[model samples]
Target: MKKIMIFGAASAIAQETAKLFARDGENLFLVDMNIGRLEAVRDDILSRFKTKIEIYEMNALDFDKHQELFDKAIQTLGGLDAVLIAHGTLPDQIKTQEAQEMIIREFNINCVSVISLASIAANYFEKKKEGCIAVISSVAGDRGRQSNYIYGAAKGGVTTFLQGLRNRMTHSGVSVVTIKPGMVDTPMTAHLPKSPLFAKPGVVGKGIYKAMLSGKAVAYLPGYWRLIMFIIKMIPEWIFKKMKL
Candidate 1:
């Protein structure tokens, strides 16, 4: 059984993934900004499985306090076998274009904070010389689009950062898994129209857990996003600029 730490425990995907771990008898250290919602998730998981559960209230953007949080979780769990960073904010591209402050705030939330948290996890895993650091990026990070370029740009930064970290930890026995998920039905994405392409949170979460176990460096879920983004990335810049995504 794994000793797992999830930074965004309250997120639908993270919650589902935690459940998967619980069912398998793994221990979990869950962190989220919403204490009430976090408590609900903790209770629900404990109700169904006989496993160790710990919850903490935290704002993901609070980078200054991240080291303390990671240390505490590691100490409580005895040792951590894996970590999942799932907290992120979707930025409005239109508002980002209208305000420089919006761009800064969005970047801070989606990129800066992620870098800070990943650093803490990476260093710990590197020293241990065995562990998995899985981060939930997005397929949008594969390329920029007219609609959500701001959010995509932030995710792109995370993808690139993971790439470099993966390179650095190549011989350290630590696996860095970058999970790029396509559209998923969640409260955060409630405004978007529903479709067959939009996957369920539980489905995506299970895919992520499986990818980590397989030690895959990069995974595109529900899988076909790989082909879709391949075509998008292959288009000529001139022709691409002329058409909408």
Candidate 2:
């Protein structure tokens, strides 16, 4: 059975992804800061799939804890075949503008923590010469709109960081995938306006699973968002800046 570790497993997308993998008999190592939610997900997975599911309370922002967490996961599962990075913080943009600390926290949660985890995973995969790292970035990264530019900036860093890691790991047989979801319906966006292209957590989760299996380097969840973003990206800056997206 393939061993998979999901960081930020308390997330809606992560929970759905866990269900998919559990049904396939994959051993899952679920990490999150919320112990209660983590246990709930663990129980749900075990009940539905009769598979091994371990939950670990983890704070991604605590860089020192990463090695310990990784060691515990490997010890429990034996080894890792794939890792999903799904944790992120989306602070209100208006609040971020008022507080410098909020911006820093957002960056630390969304970008710095990801890099820390990726570094740890890279070392493991490089030695094994086999592994997959799938990260959940955002379509907001494609273009920094005024609506959520800080969030977009953080995700953009994640996108670029994964690209760099992919470049370095190619020869080591380690694959890195970036999942850019446009507008996902989750607790994070519960209050956001409705959009025709918005995707459900399960939908995005399935897309990530398929991408991992297919060795896709980068993907847009729901697929159509890929074309939409492509066109948006192609528009000249002068015109793009003139109109609200």
Candidate 3:
């Protein structure tokens, strides 16, 4: 059985991905800030899958403590075959603009914390010369839209960071996958109006699982988001800025 670690494991998307791994008989090391939700997810998985599962309570904002958590996960699993960083926050653009602290919080959670954990994992995986590293970025990173540029900027930084990581790991037998979902229907986006463009957590989770296993460099959930982002990225800035995103 494959040994895996999932950060932000209690999220709807993360839980769904965890289910697939559990069903496949893979051992999992899961963590989330919410202890109750983390335990609930662990219990639910135990109800169906006969696999080894471990849970830890942690807030990702504890950036300095990330290395400790990664080391602990490796110790718990004997060795980590793969790691998925799925934690991030969707910041309110208006609020962030009004409050400088909001922007800092957004970047800390979305970019800083994720990068910190990924850096630690990269070092470990580099030594082994074989492993998978995956992070959940977003299509928002593809372009800076007026609506959510702050959030987009953070994800964009993540995407760029992953690109460099992927490049460095190219010959090390490591796979760094960047997952950019369009509009995902998750608790993080509960206030947003849903439409056909929005994908369900389960759908995105399945895509993430498939991509991670395949070691694909980049994956867009529902697949179509790739084309959608392509067009958005291609538009001229002056012309694009005139239209509402």
What is candidate 1's CA lDDT for residue 153?
90
TM-score each candidate.
0.98, 0.97, 0.98
Candidate 1: tens digits of C-alpha lDDT, residues 1-245: 78999988899999988999999999999999989998999999999999999999999778789999998998999989999999987766787889999998888888888889989999999999999999999999998889989889999999999999999877898999999999999888888889889999999999988998888999998999999999999999999888887
* Candidate 3 accuracy as lDDT: 0.93
Question: Which candidate leads the pack in lDDT?
Answer: 3
Model 3 CA lDDT for position 59: 96
Cα lDDT listed for each candidate: 0.91, 0.91, 0.93
Residue ranges of candidate 3 with Cα displaced over 4 Å: none
TM-score of model number 2: 0.97
Error of 3 at 76 (Å): 1.0
Clashing pairs in 2: none
By TM-score, is 2 or 3 better?
3
